[model samples]
Target: MTYTRSEFPDTFLFGLSASDPGDEALTEGFDSFRFPVHWQQVLPRGRGEPDSGGLDHYKHLIDTVLRRGLRPCAILDSSTLPDAIADLGGWRNRDSANWFAHFAETVIEHIGDRLFSAGPAARSWTVGKSDHLGTDLRAHARSLHHHLLATGHAIRAMRSYGMTNLGVEFQLDEPEANTALHAYFHGEYTKDYLAKFSPNLPKNWQRDFDSIDEPIDWCALNYAHFKDLDGSLPWSSLHREDTGETPLYVVADLGSVENTENLLGDIRSDLAQGAPIKGLFAQAQEGECLGLLQTALSGGKQPAPWVAPTKALHGHWNMVADVGGTNTRLGVVTNGHLDELHKFPTGSLEDFQAALRRVRDAVGTDPQAVVAAGAGPLRDGVIQLTNASLTLSRDTLASSTGAQRTFVINDFTAAAWSVADIKAKDVAVLQGSGSPPPGTRLVVGPGTGLGVGALLYSEGHYHTVSGEGGHMGLSPRHRDEVDVFDAARRIAPECFFADSLAIEAEMFLSGTGLPILYQAVCMAGGQSDTPTLSAKDILQAAQSGADEFAVKTARMFTEHLGAITGDLAVALIPVGGVFLLGGVADKNRWLFGQEFLDAFNAGGRFDDIRGGLNLYVSEMDEFGIVGANNFCKNALAR
Candidate 1:
């Protein structure tokens, strides 16, 4: 059967084995590439400073792979150690493990962030049986123990830099006729070998092994022959039971079409039987093998949709728009700053297109790029507004504005991106002090509707994770809250009551939900004479301390907002801080006083973690516009 990319899991990586630099074309149809970075070649002495020229070459190779949109997986080869280290006993020496770890650290310091994955050595452990290492069993065992130790040490070193995707390659040879040798190589190597040789290992060896959390993220298996593939499945299951890792099969030495077909057929069968394979790596010296693999994977499908350009367009204007439920804001970014800001009411999609045309006419020239962030879920480069009848897509934006590149993202995703460029003067701290730890940042806003998104910092870039977090179910915390929620359910059963008696966080926390909350409060408090009020009137009366129900509603709103934010913060652990956005939070800053703090810090056993998190209210009026500009500058410039 012909296999397509869609047949495999989306996260399953297909890749090629690259041999040299400037082999970008070899990676055209692959998601990743495996290349060797020799230890002796990089560090001639294997102990002191590295060769500057060697480091530069590898750096360029990694950059080229990334430019081709392929993950670069480095193989730190130690099969041929430097002559200086070879004379000093090589893998037989305990100190060699530490030296290899230092070498790994040096490489990571140069390009760790860009690396998608790495392995300690490339099929080096299997070379122990060769006569070059002599015919002594004890000596071979010592070398094997040190190799595993070096692998563990290398993994530990990478973990220190927050680079965790790591693995080890093993060559699976055919089962020997001699059962003793067969059992020793296939089964004992991973199971009983470590425990049996523990007493003979170097001092403090267990420490290094314990440092590894999951042993390896993946185990790469290279079979000696096509028929040997059947042994891999059971072997993988056994290994996973022992080490908690799945296997990535490596298809090598494909000399004929028959061999390639047989290999792929076996892989497909294995996958159908639920073999728990992680991915596939096809070893290729020419384009023939990769070409066939790509053809089968494509299954006559068309190419993917147009993606936004990664590289920035220098000396060109970029247009950005914040398409909201009530208003639409458009602006042009020139020389890395937002300018020519324009605002108008949002109507139909056609109206939005007309507004884009007007903006283009006023600018006197078409922008090189356009990005619009609307309040909704973004799917296939299109956003359907949650609280508005309008829909925005990259196609419409490009057609209307005559732009070369276009993007559509969720509104809160733009807010999350804006956190990367937010200034101190534009925000007021609600909780915690000093700068937050560098990691993920959460952005929550209450406007026409509640919106939530998170920004994760990794590989020198900020990635946005947007979703309908605002729709999460909210439960009553106390007797007073129970009465209010019951009243809310009776007032708006469709909005508050679902399969359960839980209400969505946005039902009582957003602009549209504010008046609902006010009426529910009035009804629950037996205020039969209370007049109907808009969200504005309720906030005004609460601020003036004139209406008892209005004041109670405002307090309940802020307190619930604080409680929900704290719960999300605890779940996400966004060490980069939680930023509160939108006009509601900015204008009603006084409401986020003592009661808000008390509700937010009510995490019982997790009080310390919740209370220590940095919380702020953003006062920037043009946050979405600034965020779109930041997206153009940062994300596209990558």
Candidate 2:
């Protein structure tokens, strides 16, 4: 059973499993080990005095490990449930999450320095089918929900507590299954089944139960021998079943020297098959476990920091996409920068799947991760495009594009990404004289629809506030605008609803609103000869000075946009500046002429505020795509 630093492959690992509370498992044999601290054992009384005996036990264990130049991998919580908290409805009660977070922080405050990564709760606690009776499914599901929330809170606390090296644990209940139903506990089948099983919890809570699918750090796989009388299945039957391919994985815990060698052999087979085996870990009471993985660690090579948990499976390449009403743009990114760009009409394809394939084909590259921004509302990782037939789902898109992970964000949010570090020359000055100030910035664009978002700089990072600001009520400028608003409401009542005597702005300032405004203007002027035209036609006719109705329509759209811009400036104050995007703003620079500026600057009592605000029209052809790429980079880096 004696192994050395020269016998095993380079990408192997050794670790111990702290099954009990004592330091007996802390002996020298592994590079790392998972030590579980019972909640009640440490606190004894939930929130009372610290158990001195308990504290001394863990301190001695960690100090001994550190003295031996070993890494003590602490597991904050495993199967241990404190009796005090359990009496108070442990995990089921909403307050239990906070209590658990407090415990995690306390541990980090004490022995965090000697640890390889922050101690997070075990995988068995957050995911897996309940071992309790089926009738208690509701409580069990609720417990999972609270544990996930607490996990997120603990991860954030760990980052804030200066624990950069972190790992999240996940393992298939039974790795060998023909379908995803039994293969992975984290799947739609399991989620929907659980939802049906527990209808008592809030619908929204059940719906978003799986939102935390992947962790922010590395994913640790805890595997043990599945055969023999002590284990569940017989070894002959287990080996007969295909466990499928695990391209990139981290082997965390194994018991015996035989199991360690077998798992290492499996990793070696994966490597031979041209599949990546990221790393491995061996766990045992003896030093032989570490000796077995010593050769693997002695190679002095380490896994890349970019490697992520389950979803962000690969660290080599990523993709960024902007799915808008009219166009679908894509690009390949490397090291947080755009490497290639491709574009296609949004409606030219049936759905996001075909569109992604087309873009990938044109670019001639396969990305492991994709960050797509679309113009629609996103729920449960799916987006229903506001103006197109495409429905982009994060899971579906990932499956279609051969990406291990995918993220879908609002299209406006993506466009706002470009505003973070925009140069002066890229924008045409629409109003004001100086550069943007030092506060938040706003990006409002009108195309198929009005897109609105704001950017704020905080904690040395740019945070985007994406919302439906475009649908807010509109305020008319003059008596003529009153008649115009009435006419607009008469034409398209859906766009103009008087809530407390305030009308919606999107129906008057967007591309779809332009045609409606043209019809309204014709009616106001009593010109029956004016023909119905599209927003684009109206703009062309107005620019040619051929149709008076068209001219009026263009004027109305421009002025309304300017008015909304002014209102947004006062509302969000975007001291950084207001960025104008979309085809409408980029195409009609003339429409935003003196009259539009007049309407924008005419803030009445707040005219000084408008006068001090900088206004610029964005001319970036790939603003959203660039933003998407930047967003993926920032997300991965974080």
By TM-score, who's the top model here?
A: 2
Residue-by-residue lDDT tens digits, candidate 1, 30-96: 7777787888778888878998988988989887787776778888878677777777777787777
* Per-residue alpha-carbon lDDT of candidate 2 for residues 1-638, written as tens digits (9 for 90 to 100): 33343444454445556555245655544455556776666787666566888877888877666655556667676355677777777777766666776676666656565566654643433222223424566665566566665665565455434455664554444321112212122423354545464475435764443433333445444454422213322222222342223323343445555655665665555555554344454454446544556554554543222211222111245778888777777787766777777777877345557877876554443465799898887688778888888787787666667564688888888888877778777888877644555558899999778889888877668887888877888766667766666676766776655543356667767888777778878877887665777888989999999998888778777777888888887887777889899888888788878888887888989988898888899877688888887777777665
Worst 10 residues of 2 by lDDT: 306-315
Error of 2 at 466 (Å): 1.9
CA lDDT, every model vs. true structure? 0.72, 0.64
TM-score of each model, paired residue for residue: 0.51, 0.54
Instruction: Report the lDDT of model 2 for residue 35.
Output: 66
Per-model C-alpha RMSD: 17.6, 11.5
- Model number with the top lDDT: 1
Question: Over 4 Å off in model 2, which ranges?
Answer: 1-238, 241-315, 347-350, 357-368, 379-381, 402-405, 433-438, 498-503
